[model samples]
Target: MTPRTPDAVTVFGPDFPFAYDDWLTAPEGVGSIPPEHHGAEVAIVGGGLSGLVAAHELLRLGLKPVVYEGARLGGRLRSEHFGGPDGPVAEMGGMRFPISSSTFFHYVRTLGLATAPFPNPLTPASRSTVVDLEGETFYATSLDDLPDLFREVADAWDGALDRILHLGGLQAAIRRRDTGALKAIWDALVPLWDDRSFYDFVATSEEFQALSFRHREVFGQVGFGTGGWDSDFANSMLEILRVVVTNCDSDQHLIRGGADQVPRGLWSRRVDDAAHWPEGTSVESLNGGSPRGSVTGIHRVRDSAGTATDRIAVTDESGETREYPAVLATCQSWLLTTQIACDEELFSQKMWMALDRTRYMQSSKTFVMVDRPFWNDVDPATGRHVMSMTLTDRLTRGTYLFEEGPEDPAVICLTYSWMSDALKMLPHPAERRMELALEALSHIYPGLDIRSHIVGDPITVSWEDDVHFLGAFKGALPGHYRYNHRMYSHFVQQAMPPEERGLFIAGDDVSFTPAWAEGAVQTSLNSVWGIMAHFGGSSPATNPGPGDLFDELGPIRLPD
Candidate 1:
């Protein structure tokens, strides 16, 4: 049985400018567009979550949005099927999503998608968990079930939060939306923590320093929230603090059916009749069921006489060109440099530097389907299930189990590794990866014949090897705070020159929280507002937009 929490934990609210949940519930559409401009088309590049969100919202405001996706709809939210469309799925990209992702959840709930609590490490959803390290094995059902030493390490982590970061206090300020209080606390710490690495913060903490190196090693191996964070030790402490303080790593859930449904649903969903479109208009119908051809180049549009106008022109791979008054690029920022041919003057040199300097982490996952939820079988001798959600210092850093029903085919993420660990499997075939994972699992499960229940083919992914996606997600390293600041602020194109005014950027990487889907949602909304305002439209007076409140609630800027 899962052990109960020894104490109550604080539930923090989202730490961002936008309150998307509220907007979704009572959406006073953005300022109305003049009748003449109601049918104006807006180019939405990248049909991922951000781009879809932008397009969906834009369509509601009586505008026509044409989405240009280079590949599939869901960018990093890929959920691949195994045997057939009805077969068990392997979540190749994002799987677990935090409940605090209220904005992203708004759409999930709106679409009527079912969700189950993600079995994160020793959480209650997990029947059992085994932590293996250096040939030592420990079984636990909750934090209370771990050894007392583990408890001491956990307490030290909390103490570090209270003393150095004032996590609870900051969370309170964010919940209250006390801009002054939040800014005062966060701005002061931005400089203090931005330049420091997460490892440096942990090493210098009095609580951690009092503990032995073994304790630190254990904490790094099986950290709370999102499994082992050792891969992120070299990243900026501010990034780690932001994740923890905002509650981005806890109370997570996975979308039932698949995460891809969110974007696809938006694509085929028809909204009420608006400006140029009839009552049944949808993104699918707008582009005739698929995205426009892959975009090859982007520059300003010219008139019949060849004089460039304020409109932006996008050229597809087949040499078809379309011009729009404004464009939102929601693809990975790295694509601007590697895949697409974008004019250098479209972005300032500093902005270009930030885009190019953006860092992405490597991530790998290998999954397989079983005949049944075999892990649920009881071992009479040990009085434990045959298998449990496993975390190990071995080659397989994390293993997750998912069951649809008692007899239904279950899924197992044999291995989920990051950074150097992920790179180790980059060259291996799926079968070889399964072999390596099974070998590593043997160390934890002992003599168990775990392979007997296997049903169909295995699936594997090494994000770094994918040409379209050079890496998994941004893992901001020290000194990257400035770069993030630059990227996040690019939506404010009103301050730019006329030539650079038509392009708006939105994506998870452009958000303060680089890896979370909420970031993508919020940043996309920012672009939505920017695009509306650009077209001489305004959000209802009752609901001022992000741009309207930028002076009061914008992200905290740090000193150079």
Candidate 2:
């Protein structure tokens, strides 16, 4: 738990390298359970990506997982249609995903989903970018086009990464799946950074401190990987390092149809060749073609046989109770604290602290469908696109454009704001929010008649207002490392008493790096290991599961 010095950062490896994809692809199928318990039922409390991924994996391993969803299947990966069922859509939650998310991309590629590079600020997908701050505006095709101050800021960030985090080496190690090399670097950093803030890392680093304050301001305004990182300033430095080092915030792409397809596909995907069930067995079929209603209560119960082992009794919104040998709760952590009537004995006091303290960031997205990609039109005089992908200090923090084609409708994310900016628009109606966004943009694009191209109704979301999910995603505040440690490692059920061992938690919030689908996938994989072991099933010898190596490479825990 003590901070260590005199170590080099190598590439970070995947937390679990057991490779579910490889095991599933093999003909032998990951080792199955005894014939008597081949079809044991397990309850999955959410139909989001994490729950769906766990259910799918369990199904492959011969477990019957009944999924219960409160609202929708996709959860945060929701895509809202503007015109029709097959019309242009807006990604309300997780739109862009990085290629480094190997586990998540496994499903994406398996489903044969199409993807295109996300135009992140000044990236290649964007033809041009407009940076507006403090009533000043600048347009650029790439980083080199920006003022020299931006270059200084970028170089300072790169220097900080190399000197403090060793991002390139870590990413390379991750890509190679070199666990030893990754652990050597990450173990050294966990204690030094777990308690530090992202702003502290930037403001105190000699590389950044040597630069002008204006440079730091510009850096916060348009961060290299994700624009306007000021929202993340108060978060744990460990969280920030995890994002940059693992390439989670860079080289991202948008799922072509919708990000929702990943979850929905897993639910409907028939495993005709599954190890346990007969042909045409899918999660949808197992759940009778739809998920059970929202889970309302969860409590521990003893078996009728009076065995020492514990079983979980779950009550849904309809007041119906069902008993299962095990349950996986994947809903937002806050829901467990507020919506669900969970028994105190279900989790330890330390675990409750983690779940109750989990912080979720506020986010608001406003999208408009346009007649075409009018933003792509070149200005007669300036020769730049009429309106570039925008990053601003205005009410409209970030603007993105997605064009299906010149003939088809184009979608524009008018504003994607977080934290304080998100709160500003929370009280306003979607139309009012859009009007305020246009007012702000009109100042940036004075000559362009943006309203003339509007085609369909606008779509908007304030994640904070959703009853199902109180906020957008988990954002680890400074000094929350201990809380995160408890949540992320909840899959190690052996540490819990027998009464609590049968219940598990899995979701993006329970991951080391939250707000990324990669975290969700990896944590779900961990729960699969926990649940498999709970049922006396083990991973194939060829690929030792994460739990098999948890003691050696689990998260580096700092002293309380």
Candidate 3:
């Protein structure tokens, strides 16, 4: 049997701001009714940011849409904490909010949440050290120094950075769907294809290769070879450039309280109301058919009990089956493919064969709560005193420590990038990730009396082992564009008119974001707009594809 409780998603509630109203709730006064959702104006599945945002917009339009979330409402945006008074808060997932978030800013402002730019504490005096398995080291005076040295070395090398710039310009043109510009970028970057994998590009690229020699073990932590310190490496450059041009505004911030403060509140509304939904009942199946389930609701489905059910058929977690007209699947493509068996071969072909090509990236989140901010003056990890530093070390490419509380400071999380690494490190496939963090810290701070100041044990999670999510976040890895384009394309049958069909799927994974809160919200906006338009209602949606989403949130080029 699969474990019912997930690691981070298990903890979600009023503490966060998720605009969704829960369904599995049994709080005070909220009466229960048998499961019966035969006919509703509209039913949205998956109560993450997308589902909630769409429901909110629908409500505003005077349309009462019923949302059916099988799992925790906030989905991945939920929170998990342990210990007690005087103990540390360990975040099982998610990270700090960057002020440059455009879509995030729109909703945050709606909830009256203030914003601050992401701070850079790595200073000249910071302890920015790059250590290797063999014990060689290079120290930087400040965080800026790392990038500067990288820039100098990179400049002395080949013209890869220049090629990347040209590619960025080309991408800008492509976003406009301008054939001319797209061709230009393609032409400029396509030539470098001779270098084989992005790993090869970095290996041959200048000082980039020196990192492996200098900090072999620490290198993997921050990402080395193709995924490491060489931000200018072909694939890595593409990844960074995409975010740069998109959120070019530059404001990075954290919520006033913590990360979950936003997504959780949104999920609470419905759960608190409880009066609107039936008790102990959830959406069994929705198939598109007539005026009701006409949008192919619940194509081919399975009960919570793991029995393979039909889409046009419905079955409870127990043993029950009913037919419907349409089905809206908000799960990931993999889940949708594995669970919902569709009659239409086209949707199946695009989803199973097309979207499944690319691999999911592995990731780990680590949070350390120290007795005091010993590293605040000079970050022992980065050699520089920057508030945060991206360790080019192979061990963990990303690292950030914060002294939020002066008395007993609780350093926030520093998540490192991974590629299918979570599976090798996690508990099990489809299992909740409670990562093996001791390995990384032991390698870096092997002898530091961590037991002395360490308030409680650190919390870590690896997403690679998660079968449901496959991996934590999906990235446009080497040759990803070719694979990515298919994911957001054909799987969704846009051919069906929204009102008559009533069959659609929406989630963070539907679009290029494949992950991230921004992708989640935009998916809601996009799907809802299409659905509304199909139903003769119109809604304006602002989604920043490749152009630059942060523009909507305002310029982030300032320091908070």
Residue range 204-303, candidate 3, lDDT tens digits: 5544555444332232233321224333233433444434333321334555444565555443333213334433222221111111221222444447
lDDT of 1 by residue, 1-560 (tens): 11112222222222344555555556465556766777788998898899999998888777888989877899888999878888777899999888777778878876788889998888888878998989988888887888888898889998998899988878777677565776778877888887899989888999999999988888888887868889999999988888887788898889888899988888888877455678878878877788897788889877899876898989877899988999999988898888889988788889999999999999999999999888888899988888999999999999999888899998999999999999999999999999999999998998787798888778999988886778998989899888998888777777888878889999988887888888888889889888888888776778777777676767677666
The local distance difference test score of each candidate is 0.84, 0.85, 0.43
Candidate number of the best lDDT: 2
Q: Check candidate 2 and list the clashing pairs.
A: 11-169, 11-170, 11-173, 12-170
Q: TM-scores of the models, in the given order?
A: 0.95, 0.95, 0.64
The residue ranges of model 1 lying beyond 4 angstroms of the native Cα positions read 1-16, 273-276, 303-307
Error of 1 at 233 (Å): 0.6
Please tell me which model should have the higher TM-score, number 2 or number 3: 2
Q: Say which prediction, candidate 1 or candidate 3, comes out ahead on TM-score.
A: 1
lDDT of 2 at 84: 76
